[model samples]
Target chain A: MLITNEVPDGAGHEDPGHPERPDRLIAVREGLEDLALGDELVTVGLRSATRLELLRVHQGAYLDELGAFCYEGGGDIDEDTYATYDSWPLAQLAAGAGLAVVDELARRGDGVGFVAVRPPGHHALPDRAMGFCLLNNVAVTAAALRSAGERVLVLDWDVHHGNGTQSIFWNDPDVLYVSCHQWPLFPGSGVPSEIGGLAALDRIVNLPLPAGATGDVVARAFEEVAGPVIDEFAPTWVLVSAGFDGHRDDPMADFALSSGDFAHLATWAAGLAPAPGRLAVFLEGGYDLAALRHSVRATLSAVLGDPSANEAPTNGGPGSDQIGRTLRERASTLTLVTAQRDAEEAS
Target chain B: MSIYPRTIAVGFDGSPDAVSACAWAMATGRRLEAHLVLVHARGLLDRFDRRDPRALFGDVVSELATRHAFNEARLSWHVADGDACSVLLRCAEAPVFADLVVVGSRGRDEHAGMLIGSTSLQLAERSAIPVVIVPSTTSEYHEP
Candidate 1:
């Protein structure tokens, strides 16, 4: 299911030469169309989230303040965040699209759901907008599912950790949040010890890699930490906070994950299931236009279980082995910590 | 007396650049016997929110404060709302007084270029105080 909105126009006005501009979505759509993915795609549009829906993951006062700022005409929401007339509504639409995708997938019984909305949401928190995100769409959707009696697992593979999502679910055992991001980077808060919510500490898993980590490092992280957690959780549903900013070509982050890595990860995720229709995905962050297109297409193809998805690019020699080893070590460390926590909880 | 002011106000928002600026401020604040004021603009938070930005900022400040032998009294933390440029400008223009301001070369989403970011450029353009921009790749901030 393709979930999108009139975000292209909204994003167009944010920053003219910015990397997170509307053209990124346009390029992805054009690429998918060129590849005829549209033939197999089912498109859907979403209305702006109601105040109640937003309040699930964000503070009402914060939402009010954001609206106030947006209504005031021009101001920066935070460092690296901007607001215009369209930003508030567009942010709501962006978040609403993610929820709409979850609802469609939950109702449809079978399909891959992708929300091509912008101004990414992973960095947003319960009360404020940061990292260009006004709302924590994935977190809100997961909360919605939990409220509806569905156990959820949120996997964030953005180059940067979904600190906001982790923060939101830190103490809740009902939702499992796992993220593999470049460490010593932005927000600098995803330490392994920062397991979530009181007494539910093991629910949050953070695998932080050193700078210059490559695709192999990320894949190994999935193989060692992320995949194992999902296998053990057996959650009722799985939600991916998909961010392609880890692409080797992406300028905003230093991780060197290739398009092939994204495809592999998506395909791997698609195979896990507590039910026939349990997995959903929402976009987060990716800057490089070419990498974003290729990565999204690769991920979509994997989600669709297409065997002929494009092969991993071979632009350079195999990535740094040392970094991969370091990432492996970090994941192992987190896995041990999580296991200990789980054991303690069981006792 | 020294030509450069001793007290430095650094702007941090948890980005790589922001972290670097914080590290720089810690070091510079120590060398000059000046105070380090880490100013971060808190985003809008509703009552239902659980995470505490002040606690997070305090963790970083306490870590640096202990390591540098700087008294907790000498460190100040401010959490405001709005743009980074405007916040920094306000601190620089405040009666509290600052000799210099430090920021990361590039923000979280900004690309590499001659100018760090629009906010940084604006801060440089508007501030009477000198500004320091540390590159994201720089090793100054990596040590624990």
Candidate 2:
């Protein structure tokens, strides 16, 4: 059972030339269309993210400012991020999509919850909007889960780091943030050195891969690095920041993953959940239309136990050396971090 | 005894407004003998010239450098892949920790009539340190 909310990918939140456009949503729908799930896919109308839910990961003032900005006929939030009059409402729906899916998944108790919402939220901060994100949707959901006493594990596989997610969950001991992203890319925060906040040491796992890394390298990073971290963390719920831009054809960042690779990732993520219905996936990045469709198709199908062989899994790529180096250096990094924390506390 | 603003960050986008901003920041840097960190946000989708922004700006930035002659060591360039506001804020906080941040009132994107660019305004509101927005009408600023 694949559970998700059906929200209109509104035109109210769009910039003409920006890659994070309305058509990206259409591409996702087309991907699902290709799947032909036929009654296996359950779609529900999205409820607007309540202020209480949003306040979990975002500040009250920033939300008010964003709402006011949208009401005033929003323009460019930054060079790459933009908002129009309908953006605030649409963003609310997007943020709410995850919460709705989580609840539906809980009630049904048997399906993977995948949300393909607009203005992807992993890049959004507590009080600031960055990287075309209006609100931290995944963070919001994680915080709610943590509040309900469930240990949450956020797996960010976007081509770019989910800097905002890391920052928000940095201090929480119950929530672990793991990211595998292309290094030297936008927002620039997913280095191994950024282990986690003092309280949550070793909780943040940063797998900064090279540009053309294949699924093989990523799998090793997971099996060797993230696997141990996830095992020790033993999270009750798993959330994925599922950005498909690592696809070879995506123009944004360079990663050689194909649709088949997405199938591998989704299958791996499903295994991380405590149970069958405990995993949820949210859209983060992926600009190329064709690539987005194929990747999404493969990911959802694989998660639903029907693997899409439309694209073949790739191997013999780069970044294996980097993973070995990370494994070697992790101990020293933790020792140094612990010493710094001690010195600060002693002072 | 604050002695604040010992370092300043300036946003550069190779636009005319950015040129004016550079001129103003350089002038202020001269008065205070402060470090000038020129920041350019290379968006992920940005295929904008990867070469030094100064190289892209050509004679205009060259002219600004010649006019506001300061120690070469005092000026550093940072081309980061991020949002303009986020990158500038990061420069002011860690690694750079600039005491002040400055940018043009508008960049290439803004409509000509707007009072201030969105990036400038957002930075001003969020930055812990002071921020300066150089107007397009600004000519080269000089201090006695």
Candidate 3:
């Protein structure tokens, strides 16, 4: 089910000056409406995430404090992040939407489910919320799947690194985490050398590009680095940390990706899943309203297998070639891991 | 006020023939003032599994539901993960759904004079309730 927090009360969690406002969801809903996709999209209502679900990815004390802060009329967790009286409920709704998508996909097996939620989650650490993120929505959902004994693959295509998601799964070998983001960006954590720790060396793959990187660089990184590793991992479920801030028009980032590039990346990533594999996309950080809407439509088109709906290819911005070459040259880790897995199985 | 307690489940795949079957179901649902549940089985394909059909056909379903909205009947949709026949069979027997199931006589490319398609045949044999196989010609009998 396509999920969104469409309730009128959702507006109470508002900060007019903040980029993450109620208008983001409005644009998403209107933009989807403009597409006029008949009988092809169904949206489910949002429910609040239970306290137990929040504990999956956040510290108990931090959760308690955050709830108390919100209930006490709310204030800033830090300079960039703020919470209102309704912020706690809205955040629970965001996290719950992700969990609901996981539940639907697990039961139905085949379907495209995306959550166009707010208060982006990739930057939120497990211990506390940051980067305008109140909770790690995708991390909580992934942790739930892990507890169910399902191997999961988290493909984060957001502009900034998915530091929180990576940190949550840093030690676990069952969840393969991959991210393609702009280097020298906020939170500054997605370095290639910072792959998984001692136990899960090759499980984490980071393809950090320069400011002017293009869609071609992202496509190549997926093909060269992510695809091979996913083929080796054979995860039972695939969850996407979809962030549209990488779009050329987005105000938040420096990446030069066009709207079509987002679709191209999603199409390739969707292929890594097994036949009829469940792909649940969690909305992260796309600040530009128009670009976000267009990118979401294009991504849906590609996922639904309509090539004609995708826009014509555009230039892969400046420095795209250098980034592609560098990733290809250093992408031996996935190959090495695949070969080892094959040998181990044969033995 | 919807007088009918039974909910009608129609097997739809966005095919022309399926559209005709939906029209028939809609007319019947209007007459009975029963809720309509459109079921599309987006089963597995060889290379990739079928994505949610609603992402592609939601407007069409909404339009159909609107046409019968005057009957005061609620319209809902389910895109299950299995093949059409089995999904329809399951829907027919489920407690939430009605015993009556509706389907197209034949899919897009089936013979014009054929009585039923493979899906319809399988559903007819396995369905616990009555199965209505509307032919492509039924489109003309209903109001647009």
Candidate 4:
């Protein structure tokens, strides 16, 4: 099943020469159209996320300031991020799209939910905007689910570290955060050594890959490393910080992945869900319009086990060594983390 | 037990207020006999572009050397690829482990009316260390 946004495109939020503009949503729609599901496709739109829902992930003071800033005519939040008169409302709508997908999937009890919304959210922190994200959409859904007592695994394969998502769930034992992105890149936080907080040691599995790393390396990291931790955690729900920027064609960061790689990744994520209805994907980033279109088609199609256009997963690239490196780091970090937890327990 | 500011993280982005902050940081670093870490966050746009992002760092250091006769050993600069606030915050962690953070009230591309830039506000709100938002008019405080 496919879930879409109720709000209009981010026209008011556009900045000339900016990469994260309004046309991204159009590309996503085109990918969906190519599927040709006809009656089989379930197109759903959700209401704007409530103030209470937003407050769960964002600071009240920040919400007030951001809303005021936008209404008063927004400008660049940083060197890259921008906002405008319609941004606050559009952000609320984008966040709501995720909640809407989760709500509908829970009600149906059987379909893989995908929400394609702009103002892509993984990079947004609880109190501030970073990268191009204004608010944490995936976090809002994950938080709401956590409140209802669900164990969540936030699978972020965005090519850039989802620093905001990782920061929000760092100390929470219930949410397992996994990220696979290019190392030494923007907002550089994810490293093999950043195991979760003291209370939630090993809760985070950070797999930082080198440039030109192929889809085969990514799959190995997921299935071999994150796979076991996920199984042990036994998450009741899975929320993907799905970004197509990793495709070789995108200019954002270096990771030589293809549409076929995304399909395989989606299939792996689909199997992690405790139930078919417990999985959902939220858009984050993808700069190249054509790559975004193809990657989206392959990913959404894979989730439903449907036939769609795809490319061969690339291989024989760098970063194969990263998997072993991650394991060694995890083993060493666990020693220190376990001690920290033990010391706290004693106190 | 906490020196609080034995090491100061100063943000510079080639803006007017950024210069003011750096001047203030130089004098402050000299007075307290502290180490000053000049941090510049290279955003995604900068990362994609091939231009050198740290050109301004040398100019500022030259100015400091002329005025304060600043000891180069007491200062260092870093260009981490990220947003302004995040790079400084990360520098405060393992290697640098800065005890204090500082930034200008506004940055290069901020609106003219904004009293404080997003970088300064975010640093003030998020930094684990104490933050000092140096205004553009921060008189180059020398040993007085």
Candidate 5:
């Protein structure tokens, strides 16, 4: 089930001509339409998150402040992020979509869920909104599961690093956060050296790619770097910060990934999950209309285990090889994880 | 003078439709000055399961109740260890009594009913108290 808020359909806005406009949802819907997914795709309207649920990820004061900000008719969180009259309630609905999807997946153990909500959440801090985001949806979901004594793996594939998510889970042992993002992008903080806090070195993983990195590198990063780490972690629940701005056509970033690459990445991640139903993807960022649309379709296909999903092969770039080497070197320090993976695979 | 029932009891299973029924019941309870009782059937699932069913579904129930809590009606919840329909019926016949018992036209099972779930169907048939089965198609009963 796709849990979504109708907010993207003109309920709110960032600016008049902003890239993260309401039409993005329409573009995504058009993409879903193009794929001819009848019963394969089911959609449920979002339930607004309760104040208590929001408190799971955000401080009480922050919630009160954001609520006041929105209720007072909207303002700017930063130069980039905006809030309107509809923004606060819509953000609540966006955060609620995460909870709904997790609830559905955990209970039914069936259909794959995608939360196509906005304002996009990966960049939002627990206290302040950033990069057109209000609340960190993926982070909120992870916190909910972790609080429930479930180990959660958050895989963020946005072009820009999921600094907000990483910050929230930086020292938490139960939640392992991994990101593959362009280094010199907005909210620039995902450096390779920033593994995590003192206790969480093995829990946080970042693959900071340079400009012009291809999907080939991303695929290799997951297979050689992210995959082995996930095997060792053995998380009970998997949450995806499914961002498509890495696509070559996106104006927001400079990565050369295609839609096939995004699908390929999702397939690999899905395989790493204990079960297909354990995986939930949340839309993060994808600015280019065609790129966002096709990438979303490809991701849905991959998550659904579609036999005919596209797999556009990479041309083999130096960008991927360098990242592979860096990760391989980092893997040496993660001896416990490496040994655990070996034992699990051998069994 | 409100024409609605004084005590409304709702059957909740965390399905979209069930959540919607809770919303509808709350609205009606507010109008009629009723006390709302939400009954969840844990006996429907396997008893051997390690986790507490209430703990697993507590967040959802809390969200549902909290949304309608500030209204005129008094909201309370109960976890029953029996079939949903049977438990709801028993609540209706209790001394405190439910004037109107509300339930979703369907439960969580996606394909169980053409329009109504077995619990709702049985409740509609056997319950002596007035029963209001909210259809999944009602736009007004969106999840709270």
Candidate 6:
């Protein structure tokens, strides 16, 4: 399932072009239209989350503040985050799209769902908006699942740590949050040691990479740390806070991931079968138009098990083998990650 | 091989964008018969030992230079301590003449604009010379 809302008419400004503009989604939609991927493509309408859903992970005061901030007529919320009048409603739509995707997948028995809404969510905290995010959509969804008595595994690969997602679930053992991001950038969190709360220690697995870390490093991190952890956790559902900022061409973060890497990661995630009806992805961030579009198609193709369906080759040749070597070195660290099932069984 | 003998300053931060920028710089320097300066800025090292930073920077410089076949004499590596954008600006202000300033763009988020990371933006906005914002996704070399 692909969920999206029509780009709000006349919502953008005259600022020097930023990556999180309407063009990003237009490029992605154009790419999908070009793919001719057949019946696999399912478009769904964007919806607004109810008040109860918003309260799932955010404080009431924060929501009230956000509403007030939007009502004041939109301005820079921070160095990176923007809040325009439409941002509030659009953010709700994005978060709601995330919840609806998860719910639909959960209700349909077994399938992969993708929410292609904008105003990417991973950077939003429980009470504040940062990094261009107004809502922690993935966290909200995870909170929803936890409330519904389901265990969730959140895999975030945005080139920057999903700090909000990590912080929201830090103390909750029911949610397993894994992030692969370039460290020492932006919000400047996600050190290897920021594991989680005492009870949920190790539930949050963070693989921080030096800048210039490439697709190979990402793949290895997944194969080694992320994949093994998810396998052990055996989640009732899998949620992906999919961010394309890691794309090699992306101007956002320094990690060197290719479209193929995104596809490979998606395929790897889809392999971990969630209980009966629970696997979904919510878009987070991706800036460059070509890279974002190609990466999104590749990710969806990977989830659907048909990468070749897209057909057009992305610019540039395959990446260096050094990326592969980096993955191997990083994956070796997983030897220390305790298996979740094994620990539970022993207990 | 002494054609123009220009100085090419390449910013290094151990990021893919930086590495690719360095690679592009080395190739450009070689093509232009210019000297290559691999400027590796020492970021906040409060948690890490100072010696570790020196060793790490030295290793990266040596490894990248040797792997790319740029002459040690033609390649000069310097490590400075400060904010990445500030350090880059300082380097640009130095007396050394540079034909081009090469840096990598981390891209833009809703928070940050089109120039991508702040460093790229700073260089683009403040550099005295032409700035090359190599996208992280770029696989091939771009001509100046």
Model 3 bad stretches (over 4 Å): A1-9, A307-311, A319-347, B1-144
Off by over 4 Å in 4: A1-7, A307-310, B1-9, B26-37, B56-76, B92-102, B109-133, B138-144
lDDT of 4 by residue, A101-129 (tens): 88888888878878888798988887777
- Please tell me which predicted candidate would have the highest DockQ against the true structure: 4
**What lDDT score goes with residue A309 in model 6?**
30
Output the lDDT of residue A96, model 1.
81
Quantify how close model 4 is to the true structure by its C-alpha RMSD in Å.
Answer: 3.2
Clashing residue pairs, candidate 5?
Answer: none
Where is model 6 chain B poorest over a 10-residue stretch in terms of lDDT? B107-116
Q: Residues A217-328, candidate 2, lDDT per residue (tens digit)?
A: 9878877988998999999999999999999999888899999998998889888899978999999999999999999889999888878857899999999999987776
Best by TM-score: 4
DockQ per model, Cα: 0.05, 0.33, 0.01, 0.51, 0.01, 0.03
What DockQ was computed for model 2? Answer: 0.33
Q: Rank the candidates by TM-score, best first.
A: 4, 2, 1, 5, 3, 6
Tens digits of per-residue lDDT for model 6, B12-42: 7665667778877876777677888776654
> Considering summed lDDT, which 10 consecutive residues are worst modelled in model 3 chain A?
A1-10
Between prediction 1 and prediction 3, the one with superior lDDT is 3
Ten residues in sequence with the least summed lDDT for candidate 5 chain A: A1-10
**Candidate with best lDDT:** 2
The per-model lDDT (C-alpha) reads 0.71, 0.85, 0.73, 0.84, 0.73, 0.69
Distance from true location, Cα of B115 in model 4, Å = 10
**True-structure lDDT of candidate 2:** 0.85
Please, what are the lDDT tens digits per residue for candidate 6 over residues A1-347?
A: 44333333324421234446777777777666766756655555667887799887777877887777677766655335667777778778777877776766656665677777777788777766766678888887889989989888999988778888987898898999988787655556665566677567668887777777766666676677566667787888888889888776777666777788788788878877555446787778888788888888888777777764333322332333433444454444333334554577689
Docking class of 5: incorrect
TM-score of chain A of each: 0.88, 0.97, 0.89, 0.97, 0.90, 0.85
TM-score for the first chain of model 6? Answer: 0.85
> What TM-scores do the predictions have?
0.69, 0.87, 0.65, 0.89, 0.65, 0.64
Tell me the docking grade of candidate 3.
incorrect
